[model samples]
Structures are given as structure tokens and as C-alpha cells.
Target chain A: MDRTIAIDVSHLSKTYDSYRAVDDLSFQVYAGEIFGLLGPNGAGKSTTLRTLITLLHPTSGAATVMGYDTVRDADKVRTLIGYVPQERAIDRFLTGREHLQLLGALYHLTKEEAAKRIAKLLTLVELEAHADRPAKTYSGGMKRKLDIACGLLPDPKVLFLDEPTLGLDVQSRLRIWEYVRMLKARGMTIVMTTNYLDEADQLCDRLAIIDGGKIKTLGSPVELKIALGGDIVSLTLKETDRIHSLESELKDRPAIKAVRATTKGLDIRVESPEKALPTILESANRLGCNIEFIQYNRPRLDDVFIAHTGRAITESIPESETA
Target chain B: MAHYWQEISALTMRWVRRLSREKFSMLFTLVQPMLFWLIFFGNLFQRAADTQVMQAPNYISFLAAGVVVMTVLNNGLAGGVDLLFDKENGFLERLMSTPIHRTSVILSRFIFVMGITSMQVLVILGVAYLFGVQPATGILGVAMIVLIGMMFGIGLTAISMAMAFSVKSHGDFFSVLGFLSLPMIFLSSALVPLTAMPGWMSFLAQFNPMTWAIDAVRPLILSGWTEALPHVGMVVLVMLVFDALCLYGGAKAFRRAMG
Candidate 1:
């Protein structure tokens, strides 16, 4: 309800015949925040993005972006938001500059304003060197950058990026992250949907872990990890025979929250790795268990996702389905 | 309303810029088919005047009208293919997400087809004149020819666009195009007149809308307004109904696609 909220989706649902895509989903993204809908395919991230951008009408409940109702005031909402879908929408025949000019005209921008914004976008995406080349001639990463530039031509209030970096190499993907950071720095509210957990971890200010068409949990990356109430303990062992017995002993201890044996050693989750490690070291020494290495790391978003969704995010759905 | 037109214009320009770069599409869709009819068919059927195969001043004049109608058919039906590619490739999804009126998407397509059809018709007419076939209806008859071709073009283009939106893949769309295009061309007197055909074929050609178009356009090229007027009036009425149905159906199909 705050005026600073850029998008407000409440109990929104979309169904295709008997199969529901998004169910009873509610969230608010404040202005200048980079919010992510983190989920595997069929978890309703893209569906939510589409509904908010006014590309698809929701079957039930209410949604708004910057105070404009998505359904009733869709046209006004259109002017206020920009969207880049999973697939690149560039016309292969046209040069990158031409594509931007055309989209600028669609947004009713003046010639001078369009030129200025286009130059700025090209420079921001680092595509100015390739701006005049036919889009088909550009690399996959460049084509995607052009798509993002097209979406940004209107200088929209809310930019929705649905898997914008999908299918790109790491370098190209990072370049997109740079563009997004620049946009956010300029005070633009960005709503992104991605299945890549690391991407959500690195780029999103806040994320919602969705599965089965429902929001399982929502919070900032640090907040979600902290709320998981555990630190990761990974131990590389010199011997494997006593791995199960050692894990069980560690699990029985109040300090060790959970323990599992990894290929190289033992991976554990505990209330405090520092407090749990000394006892585990003593137990290993007493049991004649040989250990090669031991380490500790904070809980990641993937751990948070698994804790809330009851399955690892990567294993929730096959890769093909998510793409 | 003004913003609506601006949106349509902007979208239409997108098609125009793309088409301008494709030499093959420009040539194949408009020229090759027309030239084949004029040279091979016209020369082969030159002495058919003795057989009464065509009811016109000469084979050239008779074939000229059919060629014009055929151009409209080819350009209109294949025009939606670009749209289908755009849809499958995600360009259409991007366009729909924009702020413009959605109808502008289809209208720009209509304008693009009509623009290409008009140019092709003129080129065909120019070639026919060079070959010594002059219209008795003169410049006015030329205008009438364009009018008939465009009206027919509008309906077929709308149907093609509807199918583009409805079909799942380009493979399925090509199958539909292959089935309807040849039959429509052959059954409707694009290569032969109704009277010259067997009784059964002519009977079916009566319901074939292309038959109506050629029947109306042939007189303007050869005889005069006096003979062409009644057929023009009837063909225009049929074309209007056909266009209304196709445009409405195409809009509904497009809406379903958006959903």
C-alpha cells in the first residue's frame, strides 16, 4: 500500500483450462529495488511477469504497477513499464540502431530524445560498436543486449526482465548484470524472473522462491540465508569407511544441526560451524577417523530454497522444462 | 485516434524496412509468377481464340486480368507468413507487450500486403500494355482492376493472418497454404475461364470467390465500363462480406494467441 511500491500483486491467479500456473500469489516491489521471482520452469515466474506487464489478463484478484491497475488501466500501465521476454525480439534484418529507433517511435518519443536515449543505451550495453550491424550478424549475447535496449527505449518506470540472460555465456551474462545495475542506479524498479539460483543471489535485492504455483518464501538474499538458521560445514576426509557413523555421531550432538556425507568428505549444516567443528574434530580423533580438510560457509539462497520448497531448486524440475 | 494511426504507421514502417532488404521475397512473390503467366501461358494459349477457350479480345488481355488477381492472391496469402515467423520468434510477443493498440499490429500487416499487391498489379499491367493489350476502360479501368485486386487481397490476407495466429507451427501453416493455395488458384480460373471449364468445375467455380473477382476485372481490361459495371458491383459486395468475416475471425484468433 505504500506509495513507494512499484508493483503490487495480490492473490493473482492464472489458469490454462484445469492446470493453474500462478495461484494466490501476492508481493510488493518497492521503487528502485531489484526484485526477483525465483523458480524453476512451470513455477509461475514468467506468468506473474506477464500478468504484471499486461500481456496476459489474470483470471482472479488484483494487480497494479505504480498505482495503475493492470487490467483496467492496461494502456497506461503499458507506458509505465518495459519488458524483455526470454526470447530475443530483434528483427534479424534490421540493424540494432534501427530496432531501437522503431521501438522509440512506438513509445512516441521525439527524434532528439530517442537519439539521446539510444546513444546512452548502446553505450550502457556496450553495443555501440555493433549498433549499425544487422542484428542477425551479432552474437547471441549482443542480440539479447539489443532486446534489453529495445525494452529500455521508453525509459519505463518498471522494467521486467524475464530470463534476460538466459542462454548466454558467463561473460555475456555478467554484461547484462552490469546493464541492470546501471538501470537500478538510475532509480528504475526492476522485476526479474530467473531459474538460475546464482543469478538470483548475485543480482536480486529481494527474491521470492516459488514452487507449485505458490510462493514458498520471500526475502532478501542475506535475510533468507540468515532465516535458514544454519551454517554449512563441508569436510574432506582421508577415509570413507566411517563416514556414515561419523555423520550420525555429529548429528546426535546438539551443535551439529544436520550432516550428510559428500563424495570427498562430509557436508554438514549446523547452528554454528565454529562451535560444532571442535567437537567433530575430537570425535574424529577418538574414533580414528582420518580427515583431509574441513571448511565452513554461510547458507546460500539455494539452501534457503531447498529448506522452504522441500527440494533442491535445481532438482525441482528438469532443465529442459525450465528453459 | 491520432495516436492509434501513429502506432499503426510505426509498425507498418517496421515491415517496410525489413521487406526492403529481402530481394528474394520482393521478386518471387510479385514478379516470377506474373512473368510465367504472361510469357508461357499467354504464348501457349495465343491461338486458343479459335477454340473459344477464353472470352476476351485476345489471350493476352484475358490472361492479364487473371495474372493481376493471382498476384493479389499470392501476396496476400503469403504475407501472414512474416507474421507467423515474428510470432514464433518472439517479436510479436514483444510488440503486444508495448503500449500501442493491438489492432495496429494487424492493420500494419494489412497495409504491408496491400502496398506490395498494388505495386505488383501495376507492374503486371505495365507489362501487358507493352505486349499490346490496352484496357477499353482506360485509366479508370486500371483503377477498377486495382480496386478489385485489393478488395480480394484484403480477405485472403486476413484469413492467412488468422491461420498464422491459430496454427502451432510453420510446418502446419505451410501444409494449410499448400492445400488451399493451389486449389484456390486452379479452381477459380486464375489460369482458365469458367465457361471454358467442364460443367462440374464451372459449377464449383461459381462459389469460388476468385471467379467473381476475375469475372469482374476481365471486362475492364478488354471491353469497357458498360459490360464491367454490373459484375464490379456484385464482386465488391461479395468481397466486402468476405473481408468482414475474415477480419473478425482473425481478430478473435489473435486475441486467443495473446492469451
Candidate 2:
């Protein structure tokens, strides 16, 4: 990658009345990289994307897309970016083809150019067969495909997708992931937000784990997992009240990196599970806490989230926050 | 400037296409005004109303102008329903995020409503012809009536769009729409002549724009160009000021919603 910055957000903050939706945040998205904002609902992911797309004005600070200031040169910035919002924006009364045709006109394409581009995009999203059907008849997956096709109408340099695979079936999600990778192959910079762990791990080149409208940590999935040291040993104990005692005992070991108590029990991060397994068993036996279940595995993104925010991402935030 | 109009035309065509696809709505929108107001109510009141007081050949001929202007008022006030739906569904956000001029959205809606209002006015005139009501000003005068209807619609539609942007929900918008349309129609000379109206209603009707529009259109249908021209000029001047205030409020509401 040439490391050209496609987007630069500096101290971007947005507030609704007294509630701060997006705090003073800063980040840079490199050209041709699929950057993901991984957070639970209401963690400021959509607000961040909306600001970058110029759908909103920031309360303070600034952002730029392709060097055009989002606030100052909004029209120029709009020419370079496409946004797919979290809500389904399809007009149920309009056919799939009509939607694209209208979008083409908004983008200022000539009649012939719009027709040609619409045909190509319909084929790309595999909606050509049902192009004449009203969007109300489309399935959930098909509607999302149409939304993606509409976003691609401008041949935008950057695409902002808010929860691209949200409410999608497994097959539809896999197909959307394939399409996203195809776009990245064509060198389009994609910035997507998702609360799904597997989506962030499988699709994003790098992600920022966010909480309470703040970025808890930021890195590639592999780098974040590796940063947790070696392996995670999760143990379920019968004597749940004595769990804190085991954490203190495990914390004294030089080989142990960190220990966290979850609903499932204690998760101990160790340099080597093989060397630390026997010590763990002996400590449990000495403490008279019966180990009902135990397992060891390489660090996953869940552990990475747990390591930074001190809680699992899925259970960390309430779902009441508007996406 | 060319690109701006092009975007507006594209958006206008979108509304045109959507309405065309609704086979039921298109049929009813044209038919309902004539069926209820012109044929049924016009005949029902044929014996009750004094044609001499109306200064026309019959009640229906005098009522013809009322129905025409009434169509413009109803269509214009209901114009923003589609936009309110678009806002709620997030399609408005999608359009705003595009590179097109923001004002094009409002202008395109204005064109679409006026086009439909013009079509309904023609249909109402045709139905009135079947009932032995002819415009004394002839074909050119009929064209003028449509133009006047569109001019009056421009102001009502602007106010409707402002309400759409200002209200929090469709429920509130509908409430406001109902509140404005029924009262405006009753206070005007649509259902009855100003000479036959109650003293207080006649006084209120003088201040109503609907009354100005109806009064302007009635002369074109019942009297010749000599009688119609003066009323036309007066309504035109009144509409210019009405539209200015409406568009100003509409633009302010649009800016606030966008922000």
C-alpha cells in the first residue's frame, strides 16, 4: 500500500443538545484499506461515519475527505464519497432500476451514461432479473444489495457503510462480505461500522474497538490478538465467591500477563499455556475451589476487547443507543 | 444554473413516475373532486342557491371555479406528505448527502404538485362542461384559469413543505394539514357566493387567499376577459406576496432540518 490518506478526521465531535454523540475523536484512513469501526450500538460509530460523509455538521473540530474539508467543500467532498446509512433508505414505491436512475441524475450523469452505469451496477449486484420490481417486494438481503448498488452509483472514491450486514442471514452476509472485498480489490477505500465481532475480524484490515463514544483500542485483528501475549486459559469454578482469591494468586506469577473474571469464570492470560497449566491446576487444588470446566486457546478478538475495556464488547454497552 | 434545473427535473420526474405507478390513486385523484363537489353537491344545491345572486347561468357554473381552486388548495396542502415519508424513511438523508443542489428538492416538489393541480383543474373544467357550464372567456380563458390555479398552488405547497420540515412526525403534520385545509375552504367562497355568506364569514373570506383565488377564477369562467382581467391582476399581486412569505418560511425550515 502507498499509505496515502484517503480521509483525515481531527478532533471531530458532534452533540445533540446536551448529549455528546461523538466525542473529540481523531483518525486517519489510508487509501485502499478497509477500515472498520467496531463498537456496540450507540458507541458513536454512525455519528463518526455521518460526519465524514458530510451528512452532519460537527459540533466542533474538522474532517476532510480527499483533502476537501467536509464542512467547507461539502459539495466537492460529496462527489468523492457514498454513504449507506444504518436504516434502510429504499423507497418501497420505486423499482430497483428507478432508484438507480434517480441516483444517477443526482450524481449528474447524462441519460446514456446513467443507463449504462445502471445496467452495469444491476449486473454487479445481481439485481438485473428483478430490476423492474418494486423494492417492497424485495427480501431483506436483496434490499441491502440494492442499497449497496445505489451507494456505488457515483463510483465514489470512498464508501461509508453503516452496519452493512446488519439483520442479514448468514448466506446474505457472506455474499455482502464478498462484495466488500471485491470493492477493496478495485482500490476503493471502505469505512464500515459493525458490532459483530466476526465481521470485524473477518473483513476489516484494521479496526478501532470503541466504547462510550471513545476508542478503547485500535489495530488489526491479528495484531490486537497477538498483543494480548500468548494464550488464554478460561476456567469455570464451582466456588464462584472465591474467584477474586484465584485472580490475586494468579496475578503474582511472572508468566501471567492478566487475569479477568467474567460470567463464565476466570480468564488468565499466560506466556505459554503448557507451562502455566500445571501451576493453575495446583493453585485451584490448594485454594479448594473445584474446577468444573477448563479450556485453553489462542487469543481471539473477544479477549482483545476484554483486555482493553475490562468487559466483553457484546455485553459492555446497552443496545438502547440509537445506531 | 443548467445543472441545477436538470437535477430539479430529474427529481420532479421521480414524483411523476411514482404517482403514475399508483393506478388507483391517479384514477381517484382526478375523479373524486368532480364526483363529490361538482355533480352531486352542485345539483343538490341547484334549487337552494340563487343563481341571480351568484351572477352565473346556474349554481354548477359558479361552483365550477370553486371546485377548480379547491383542487389546487387540496393538492397543494397535501403536497408534502411524500417528502415527510421520505424524511422518516431516511431517503431524504440519502438525497441530501448527494452532490445535487439542496434547493432542487423543494423546487422539484413544487413543479410536481403544480403539474398535478393543473391536470385536475382541466378535468374539473371538463366535468363542468358536461353539466352545461362553459367558460365565457373561451379556450384562452380556460388556459388562464389553469395558470391562476397553479399560481395559487405555489404558495400553499410552500407552506405545506415548511410544515413537513418543522413537525416532529407525520401525525403532527396531518393534524396541521387538516386544521388548515377545512377551515380555509369553508371561509372562502368555494361552496357559496360571498353575497349569500353570513356576515362574519364574508368578512373573514375577504382576508382568505383561497377567496382571492376563487374570486379570480370565477370571473374567467362566468364572465368574459373584460371582467376577468382586473380580478386576475389583483390575485396575481396578492399571490406574489403570499408566495414570498411562504417560500421564506419553507427555506428557513429546510435549512434548519438540514443542519
Candidate 3:
């Protein structure tokens, strides 16, 4: 099924004085699709999301959300998108019910409409039983639910989620994933950013791998891996001896497209793992390189990333979040 | 909620609800700080009643206007704590992302601060009345007293919010609060008459809006319109300029922060 574009960003850049947070980055999100911005921390994913949401203005270029310019038509754009930031934006002093009610009023919903909507949201987020309790008593997951509920108050067509599951526990993250999927099913276009490769792999129908304010790669999970084609075969040698010869021959093979050296061994990208493994072993033996360990893995978003950027995405998340 | 008035009221109701839930913080914020000035200082200066040290018959009557301004002082100076908290918690960003009018944020805060200040002012007036102190201009004079308190309150609240938006952190905000609050209170006639203050202090008090508010209010309580009218008019004019300046700066900081 062909879908309309929900968001169009063109050469958008945001600079904070001497720092270029997002530089000439661009991507398009489709209607009713969950489009993820996949990157490590400080990869300008959040900066791009913020620009699209109208929280931060672009230093150059333009973005339109639901056909309204993000800068010039910010109020109109605001009306059509709900934003959930990485931080817990809930006021702990207010009850869960109060938070929804407050947002309802801010959105100019009528009393009856607000009450009805708030009730439905509370049930949807599974916080109905604790609706009247202060959010300070809520578990982290419950608080996140309330935060999402606040964003949904306006019933926006497009939702902007910046690192929504960044600090959440596994259970909380799964709950959010379920909710996001549900929202997509209900015809909401969700644009989310995440450092977790699995989240982008699981939730995003299409994603952009961004680094250094540029989209290094973009496609559906299957398409991206297929485009980079192959299994990731990392083999560690006993020493650095003949590793260079092995790397050169691995690249010469028709099935292997890219081969880069890892600290431990060679990260070779082969079109078909089963077909390439025997040949790779023979090549290593022929080169007189003693193999201490070998690993054959399915191609993941990380491998796709490494193939494009020449560096592995460090999976250490919290340390980078702090930085 | 479609009406502009309804939106402001609804926003103001949020602050009121948060305050109501934290009853202890509300009670302490309103009562404790002024307890020393009202109970302790009023008694310590009891001897001033018989002397011509002040124009009023007793020191409490002389301290009455000061109490009202002090109420405004505490309420106004701490006004930005909520705004700063909202900024930190990302609520301010949330509110801005919505279609709600930006001016409503500031206006609702003004309404909420003035509402709480009115209640505190009433308590102070009621206590002074119980001490045999009555406004020479009657209930009309009491109304004018609250009006002057509000005018000064709005200016301080604007300044607090401006600082809240401009500063880097809450610690810096509180440091600013500590640096400014007591000096403004002491420089003004909240604790003593202008004549009794040293020459340099008295000269500085003339430029302090808190002093202008208290001086304007004191006459209405002690000697009625004949003496209070000019001071009241001057305070109104100064407060108008003060509010304009503070609001302009506050709105600028708010816009810059949002950007």
C-alpha cells in the first residue's frame, strides 16, 4: 500500500554557537508508519527530532510536519503532533488524573470531551486503577504511561518521541513498545529516536541510521540488511600474522562486499553466510593465520551501521546519555 | 476553555491545586517567614509606642503596612520557583509545545500570586485589627493597602520569573534569591521608619519599590487620604514603570529559553 508522506525534512541544520548538533540532515516519514531515527548518543537524532517537533528551530533548511512548516507554522504544526521527550515530564505532585485533565484543558477540549478522553487514555495506559493517585507513587513504567497520555491529549496525527525508552527498564520499554505499536495500528504516524538497535529493528518499519548529523543509511530493517548484504563473520587470529593477507583475499571474493579489521579479528561481510564460511576458513588456513576463535552472526542493524560508518556502534547507552 | 479568561483561570487553577495538595509547604510559606517580624519585632519595639519614634499610636500599627509588603515580598520573590521547576521537569517545554497562548502562562502566575497574597494580607490586617489598630480611612483604606501590595508584588514576581528563565540552574536562582530578598526587605521601611534609618539607607529606600508601596499603604492606615494620596499616586506611577520593565525582560528571557 502506498502511503502519503507525514513529515518532510530537507537539509535541516541546528547549531549551538560553535557546536553543530544537527548538520544538513534530512529524512521523510510516511503516514501511519513508525519511522525511527537510529543512532548512538549525540548522533544528532534528538536534535533532528526536536527540530521536527518545533522545540528547537533549525539553523538552516526547512521541515514540514503534516504539510505545515515547522518554523513558520509552528502553532499549526503543534496542533497536529504530540511530543514525548526523553525525560520524565510528569509533575509528581499532581495526580495521574490531574495530569491528563490539565493537558485536556491546554488542548481546549470541552469539559465533557476532556473527561471522556482522559478516562479512555487512563484505561488505555492501564493506569485507570491509580488515576487519582499522585504520580510520585507510580512505578517508572506507570509514570511513563502518564507522560504518553499527556502527549496524546490532542489526538495528533503525527507523534514525536525522542528517546522514549532511553532510561526505561525492560518491562517499561516493552509496555511502551506495545503502546507505540497500538498507536501505529490506530493510524498515528510515530517518529521516534532510539539508541537501542533492537528497538529500531522491532518497532520501526523504516529507519534512518544517523551519525555526525548525516544519514549514513536509510531503509526498512530487511531492506537495509539486504542492501548491505550478508552475514557478519568475525574471526580472531592467534596473532596479527597474515591477517592483512586474509582481509585482502576476503574482499576479493564475490560474496564478500566489505571487510574491516576489528580489535579482536576481521569483520567480513558475506552475501551468504553458509556459502562463504567454508571458503573463509580455507582462505584463513591458506594464509597460515591460526584462528583462535570464530563467530558467525546474523546481520543486524549494528552490522549495517558498521558497514556504512566503518566503526561499531558502542552499545553502552547510559554513559553516552550522561555525556 | 475556548474563552481567553477561561484558559487563564484554568491554568491558574493548576498552581492552586498543586499548592492545596502540599498543605504543609503552603502553610509554612505563608506563615513562618513573617512570624518573626510580626510577633518578635512588634514586641521588641513596644517601647516606641509611648515615644514620638513613629507617627502611629503603637508600634504594631506602625508595623502594619510593613507586614502587608512583607507578605507580598515572600510571595513574589518565590514566585519563579514553580516556573524553574517546570523548566527542569520539562513541563514548561510541554506547555509551550501546546496551542495555548504564551501570555497566559505569565498572567496566570500573576493571578495566582496575587490571590495568595490577598489571603495573607487579610490575615495580617485581621491580626492588626485585633490589636486595636483600625485604618483611618476605614474599609476603603484597607482596600487601597491591598492594591499597593499587589502592584509591588507583580513587579517582584516578574523579576523572579525573569531570573528563573535566565539562570543556568536552581542553585543559581536561589543564590540570587538570597542575595536580593533580605537586602530589599531591609532597605525598605518594612522594619523601621524612613526617618529612623541612617541617611544612606534612607536615600536608598527612596528608590526601592517596596518602600514606596509600604509608605503609600502606611498613611492610609494611620492618617487617611489627606496624607496618603500623594504617596499612593507616586507608588502607582513607579509600579507601572516597574511592571513594564520587568515584564519586558521576563518575556525576553522566556522567549530566549524557549528558543
Candidate 4:
């Protein structure tokens, strides 16, 4: 309930029939911070963002954005927030300038004010050259830029972006990331949800990794990577059965914390992969097994997800009747 | 009230811009109704004349009033499809999240449809005049007919938008349109006189709001406002009921959709 909290979600739950899309979720986003909701597809990240934006009502619990209750004060919430959905919502029939002007009108800006904002926003998104072209004529990156420009028309206090870079190319994604950073630098509060681990790592000040409609972990990127221990040693064995013996042998080792079987090989979380790898290789060789591939690197957000959820982030989620 | 006017102006401008940009699509929309008025109605009235069913001094003028009202109703009702398209394309959600008054969304659409309908009415009226169908009264009566036609148009627009919000598929829209149009046109004295119909048919016509609207305006075009004030009052009352029902239903549907 603090006035400084840009977003306050308290034990929010949303259910579709017997399934829960967002389950007993609680989080707070501070003002002027870029908060990332990181999760794979169907992990309820979008659901949580939608609830905060007042697009979908939660079955239980409550959320407030910029000190206004999402449900009770929806109009006020709308006035204070800008929502950029996953899909490009710009009218293809309308020019980019016209689209922004119409959106500006919806925000109650007069003609002169709307024109000024439209010009500024189009330039900010780097779409000024193509401002008069219909949105249908724009490329994917241009369309996305226009979408962002539309969201910025109101100069909102809080902005909710759901998978903003989902379908963009690498260069366009990087461009968008730069814009997001600029927004953060300008002291705007942003709540963004993305399945892209790299995006979360690059743009988010703090992120919450959600899986199965629950927050698996929450912290800054460095904090999360630190929580996974020292380093991850990935070893591809010639035989899958060798993983169990390797795990059994390494379980009591001083440098290793845990060794689990991965699809390509065995992943060992250790205090120091550099020191433990030589011993692990000697042990594997003495056990008469050949190592196909071996790699030791810092833990990634994907590893953090696998460590907590016991599944790979890239795997398709099993279908449930969850809304 | 200023906010409402502002919203209306904003929405109206958006629609006008869109129509101007998509000239081909706009032409397709305008041509169908124009053809119905110029070709189909013209031929149908000519046949009726051969049979003496349409005994008015100028059948084309009588038919012109009905055609204008019909065009306005059809265009207004069909405008909800644009809302449905906006919803499907995700634009509606974006709009809903804005600070604009929600009622303005529907009202803007009504204003847009009414404007388009007025343009089409003028074109059809010009064509009717060229065919030797002259209005008995001057500009005031013509303006009154257009006003009543627009009111009825707004009501249908609201009802159509309400349905668009409730129904999930485009197929449902076509089916609903087909079902509503024939019954509404037939129940009114749009194509023929109530006296020429059976007793039950005439009774049904009396209850049809379209009948009241057509009757109120037909005299203005064919005989001037020798048409009684009570007749105009009846049309206005019926129009008020339909307008209220549609506005209420559309707003309710919109709230549910937003949820």
C-alpha cells in the first residue's frame, strides 16, 4: 500500500474453471524501475501483466498500479498506465502519424497537443521518415516501433510491455532494448514480461523467474546467477547410464554440489568447475567411459530455471485447461 | 458534454481519414446500397406501378424516402463489424486501456455511420430527382427526414455494435444481419402500403418503428408536412425506445467484453 510502489500485487490468483493461470502471486514494482517478469511460454507471465494492466480481473487478491486499485479504480489506472500487448495493435489502414494522433485523442489531448506529441513520439521511435505511410506498408520492426510510439502518446507513469520483442530480429530487438533503457533513464516505471533470457539479462534491473504460475525465484541477474553456486560443468557421456555413476562418485566430492543428467550430457553444479573438471574427467576415464563433449561456463538464467523447475525452459508446456 | 463532443469529433475524424485512405473499400461499401436504391428499388417500383399498387403521385419520391432510411439503417448496423475487426486485431484492447470515455467509442461509431449514411442519402436523392421524382416541400422537410433517418440509424448502430461485442465470430454477424434486415424491411411500409396488406400484416406494420419512420417522412417527400405532428411524434417515441435499448445493451456488452 506504499505510495512509492508503482505496482502492488498481493496474493493474486486467476483461475479458469479448475486450472489456475496465475496462482497466489505477490510482487511489488517500485517507481522508476524496470521490473522484468521472466518465464517461458504458458508460464503465466502474460497473465500476471494483464492483471496488473486491468485487462483481466484476478479471481482472488488485488493489485494496484500507481496507487490506484486495478479493478475499483480502473479508469484512473488506465489514465496512469500504458499497455503494449504482444500483438501489433496499430491500425494497418491508418498512417503511423494518424495512429498516434488517434491514440493521443483517446488520451484527451487537443489537436495541437496531439500533433506535438505525435511528432515527438514518431521521432523518438525513429519512425518520422515513414510517419505518413500506412502501417501495413511498414516492416516488422517499423510496426513494433509504431506500437511503442502509440503507448508513449500519453506519457504514462507506468508502462506494461508484454513480450515486446517476441518476434523481432536481433537488430530490431537491440534497438527496442535501447529505447527501454532510455525510458528507464528518464525515470519511467516499466513492467515488462519476456521469455527471452538474454532480454531479461540485458534490460531488466530486477527480474522474477516465474514457472507453473508461481515465482520460482526473484532477484537481480547477478544475484540469481550467484545463487546457482560457482560454475556449471556440462559433460556429454558416450552412454546415458554413466551419468548415475558419475553423479554417485561426485556427490561426496568437496568441489561439487550436485550432478544431474541433462539431455545432451551430465551437468554438474560445483564450487569451481575449473578445479573439479580435471578430477571429474579422470574419474570418468577410470570408469571406462568416453566424454563426447565437455563445457564449463557461468550459469545462465536458463540454468537457474532448470535448477528450480526441474525442466528445460525451451520444452513445450504440457496443455492444461488453464486460461 | 464537452468531453462527449470532443470524443465524437475525434472518432468522426478517425473514420473519415480511414475511409479516405481506403478508397476502394469505401467505394465497395457505398456502391452496394446505391445499387439497391437505384436499380433494384427502381425496377421494383416500376413493376408496382404497372400493377397500380403504388398510387402516389411520384413513386420514385416515395421510394426515395424509404431507400434513404433503409440505407441509413443498413450502414449503421453494419458499422459494428468495424468494432469487431478492431477487437480481433487487438486495437479495441488498446483503445479500452486509454483514458477516453468508453461511451464515446460507441457514439463515435454512430456519428461516423450517420455521416456516411447522410452522404449516400444525398446521392440517392439526386438520382431520384433526375428521374423526375421531386420533393413536395423545401429544404426544411428534407432536413427533417434526414434527421429522423439519422436517429433511427444511430439506434441500429448501437444494437449492431452490442451484437458484435457479444458474438465471437464473423459468421454470426452475417447470420444476424440476414435475419434482422428482412423482417424489419417487410414489417414496415418501406416497399408497399399498409392498406394493401392483410389485417394481421397491417397490425404488424403499426408496431414496427420503421413503419412509423417511413410514414413520417414519406408524406414530407411525397405530400409535404400535411403529415400530422402526431405521426412524427410516434416515430420519435419509437426511435427513443430503440435508442435506449441499444445504448444500454451495447454498454453492457462492452463492459462484459472489457472484463
Which structure among the candidates has the greatest lDDT? 2
Q: Which candidate number maximizes DockQ?
A: 1
Could you tell me the TM-score of candidate 2? 0.90
- TM-score between predicted and true chain B, model 4: 0.90
TM per candidate comes to: 0.90, 0.90, 0.91, 0.86
Residues forming the 10-long window of minimal summed lDDT in candidate 2 chain B: B29-38
Candidate 4 stretches with Cα past 4 Å from truth are A1-4, A16-19, A110-117, A237-291, A318-323, B1-4, B28-32, B48-51, B57-62, B182-188, B192-212, B223-230
Residue range with the least summed lDDT across 10 consecutive positions in model 2 chain A = A314-323
lDDT accuracy of residue A188 in candidate 1: 95
* Candidate 3, residue A187: how far the Cα is off, in Å: 1.6
CA shift of B104, model 3, Å: 2.0
Worst 10 residues of 1 chain A by lDDT: A314-323
| Local lDDT at A168 for model 2 | 95
Summarize candidate 1's per-residue lDDT along A129-185 as a digit string, tens digits: 999988989999989988998889888999999998889999999989988998999
Error of 1 at A20 (Å): 1.0
After superposition, which runs of candidate 3 have C-alpha atoms over 4 Å from their true positions? A236-266, A271-290, A315-323, B48-51
Ranking by lDDT: 2, 1, 3, 4
lDDT (tens digit, per residue) of candidate 4 on B116-210: 88777777777777888776777887787788888888778888888888886889988999888878887878877788888888899888778
Considering chain A alone, report the TM-score of candidate 4 relative to the true chain A.
0.94
Relative to the real complex, the DockQ score for model 1 comes to 0.66
